[model samples]
Target: MGESLSQRLQHPRRSLGDRHRSQAEKFLRLSNQGEGEFSVNIQWAEQNARQALLHDFTHPENWRMLAKIKVLLADDIGIRALLSDLFAVLGRDPEYVSQLEDVSLLDVGSELLNAALQNDHLDSDIWIQSFDASDVDSFVERFLKLDLSDPRCNVLFGRRLERLWDIAGSDVCIHLGKVLLSHRPQNYEMWTNLGRAHERMGDYDQAWLCYDQAQSYAGHLTVRDDFKERMESHFDGNSSVAWSRPEISVRKDFLVTMEKLSTRFSDSVIDTGASNEEVHVDQSGDERRLENMLKNGDFSSAFFLSRRLVTSGEMWAKEYLEASKLALEGKDDVIIP
Candidate 1:
């Protein structure tokens, strides 16, 4: 059986993309030569083009080829959707969005794709091909400059980082994964990838935490349980000692570390507009701040703050923690102040 769409997305093969794109180009040329049935030849071209995209979505050429096919079919809506998907992969740069606002894609789809290719700043595959992976510092410096808020870009970069785990090491994955997750904590696949990186590095406790987060967002997933089973199997024939989750204090310390790492890349600054003196004078300052964070849909920050407060023996923060967890779980009834 062929790989599922999720599997292809999670583990893209560039060689497959190249092969399929070559076939697509061949079929497209044949279709344009007026040799066989035009519709059948074009449909074959479209199928191969689609496969190319599925194999390597980070490739601008693959997107452009598909967009061209869509235009040939006079699929205006498909062209718009394709452009939207391409914009998502590019991190939705404001320049592209603004330029496309009043433009007709049907009239100039190819031109727009050319413009996007020239302006793309978030193509992880391009970065991977252009940058030296062995130079971790340089690579990370370039990576940090990109807008990591888009989950699609994060996932693409995360997959690339996973491929470079041996050279770049798991720490880079953990650091950048935390940074990206701070912006879009709902990315369960990224959480799973981060967990795999940690597990590969023998950081079982941190892996458990990441897998736990993944399961939290996608309860039907068995990543956490699978991790536990793997741990158990690792110790099966070796010794009587069995693996267990880290102690509460240890887990809390891990969360603290993640919280600190996330803050380094987080763009959201909680501006209370209150002076230090006013904050010191107000007894409910932290509570108000927590409420504001929740109201702003900044659940990542809210979770960390509420957890810290609750750990410090502030009982009021317990409610906030509950509310933050509910909100994170996407409960509709959880209302923010």
Candidate 2:
């Protein structure tokens, strides 16, 4: 079996990161010494710096080293993107965002990073790195206290969860993905990524649903069709067996379960003890809520509520669900769900 989540969380491979950082610094020094081709040494340095980050993203030094290398290579855009990623990891503080206004990242990337590090060093990635399993409740408490409403922050968390999936399991990835999607349902790429995670975990039914959502959001995308093809390929040459989408009821159940799991960690969810299914409102109120979600371009939430109402035998909800699907497909003039 793979290492447990607690064990992996407790050890962020700092030693490996240090080793790679050392190697990167050595290569950088060699490049300056002119012992060999400067480009070759810089290439080696870049490789090691990247490995260092892959091993331990929490280390601010690792990020700085990579940013320095990008500067040496005159990759201004790369440096900017790196800084953006760091800001995302830092929860996209307004101050940090403002510091970049009318500024050239190529010249001030390092200084900006330093300022960010000084302003607030309480990075969730760093917390994950230094996590102590002795107090599991404390760890959970700290995690729950994070602001998860930021899309970039959620993306950063989703990427970290993906990297740790082998040790932490696919459920974590699924939960994080749902949380991110709930905030930005228009991110079809993330939907595809979530589908891939589900596919890896053998949750084909859930995978199909995710892919379906992705395709619905981007009509030209073929991820859902590609998934179906892959499924069919597995049963080729078998006349009796075939792959198919789950029944509407099964899909609805899965969505509800996923929504509950996501809301468990999401700060946006209401504090009420009632689950979505348990929250009973008059039919008019439900319709108004659905309409408001559609007006706000919250297609994912609108889709879920419409589907739930349709499953409960509300014919009006069928129209809303179809409208939601159309809006998700990029139809601008569709009625609000």
Candidate 3:
């Protein structure tokens, strides 16, 4: 019985290894299709690399090959995503960490290192050296210029914007915000962040406009109302050029009053988790809150929370995170379910 069980386990392992190697070879062949020039069909190579990772995520060779291809293709976002995944996997195992030391990254440059470096303390390192760069603007610039029909990719770019905001502050992000808005004018989260960035730079007029646009585009109640309140506080009820619209002021006052009243009744208890079905319902409810966080442009919270859900085997959260990743590569139509 022990021998039979061991053989069954080894059989699956052998099959997975075989599939991973086949896919890796396919990736290499396609990646070098036009070795001396740029005529090679790189898309096919990318697809195979993706397949290789799916078969056996722990394979360092596949990670290195894909990283090289992503660099060659100037797919900075793809490289970061690849490295991030590789580190997430390999960082957990000591043997894999040692193997990572021998990998040779290609010419995609230090931007990859910069990304790893910036988030290194928080996550994986994979023995890759950090790049000497002031910022990840080059990668961001490349990402912004690409098409963004995929909603999940839209969020990943939002992560880039978040990083830009953190490293360079609001001035730099405002411009990138404009570029993103030009493509996705209805992204309320982008509008809110743009408004905040403009506010930080003391560009009140632009800030007011962004805030107003955010309120208009907000599909969620919490975000839309928050924008309204921000506009009021910024203008301070001075109905001059800043307060050209009467309705916005009314909304601000009404929401502020409502908030005050809600706080007064905030001590009220809300029952939860009374039964198995209720516990399941609560989980679903928590997932909805997570969805709202993603929609509200809170990528940091969404990402961390998604990580927890992934460990807990929440299929929906996993799907959402995967869609966001696929969106980074511009490979799918991510509707953000």
Candidate 4:
């Protein structure tokens, strides 16, 4: 009986704490190695870290370490999941989570942003306050990569998008604004951002349409009046739609051909960048001359100006030039303001 009991003790089952500690140590060993095999080490570290959490779901240290690993891997979805777990385990103990300064999980529609301003070490505040135009692409890229399915993540991303729009212009604005609208269709701020994006893209008709949608769902009279003022300011008494080109008559065959060609160009734009496309502009001395020619129905001069811009890699101007050429051909079906 003594020998049997001794043999059983040799292969004793480990407690959850002991198993979690062993996995954590293995993760640390792989993570602390020098940089030569960094990717391989990180992969192993992540596996061990995940195993640690599985063995001891209540361990805050395991959750914190896993979140750090996810952040280093640029695994946005993984980071959010770790954060959710951390937030749950550290409930009412945000300070513990906050001390893990490498990553942050902001509370949606809370005073967290204001609180962050007071905490110099807060990662979100540091990023936002130090933003520069040169860093705009990378800044937007980081957020775009995130899986914002969580409402807290969604609200945080929406705020970042609003700031990004002010600097990066229509492309970022339109992309994020549309995403926010899909999740919160009645959000006045989301509609306002979308309308602003459309307005900047030279699509006034679409802009006004978005603004009208904003007014319909607005909770405050001030919000509706603000949208109305914006719409009124855009037209400035022109009674003209931004999308309409010069009136010209063409044969049915020619119009059909143009439509097919235009469709191809539109499809190319849609295919090239499925989610994060940008608007490229190459402003030059000829911009005013091109505008003047187009306004005066001088397709000859406008064609030359647009051609020069397109050759300089201003692809956004290509559509406008194509429409001008169609107009010069005595008929255009491309513009339907």
**Best-fitting candidate, scored by TM-score:** 1
Q: Rank all candidate structures by their TM-score, best first, as comma-separated numbers.
A: 1, 2, 3, 4
Leading candidate by lDDT? 1
lDDT of 2 by residue, 1-337 (tens): 5632222333357788889999999999999899899999999998898888656666778888988898898887677777776765566644564567687777888788777766545354554564443544443344455554443344445555454445555665566567666654555667888899889888899899889878876666799999999999977887576888877666666656544443443333322125543544357877886787677765656666676667667778888888876675452221100
Error of 4 at 335 (Å): 50
lDDT of 2: 0.66
Tens digits of per-residue lDDT, candidate 1, 107-226, equal 987787778776653465455565465678866786666665444566666666655566676667677777767655656788898888788889999899889878866666899999
Among all windows of 10 consecutive residues in model 2, the one with the lowest summed lDDT is: 328-337
Of candidate 4, the 10-residue stretch with the lowest lDDT total is: 265-274
- Which parts of model 2 are misplaced by more than 4 Å? 1-89, 92-145, 258-285, 292-300, 307-337
Candidate 4 structure quality by residue, lDDT tens digits, 21-42: 5665565566676645877777
- lDDT score for residue 58 of model 3: 35
By TM-score, the better pick of 1 and 2 is 1
TM-score for each prediction?
0.58, 0.50, 0.34, 0.34
- lDDT for each of the candidates? 0.69, 0.66, 0.47, 0.47
Cα displacement (angstroms), candidate 3, residue 208, comes to 3.1
Which should have the higher lDDT, number 1 or number 2? 1
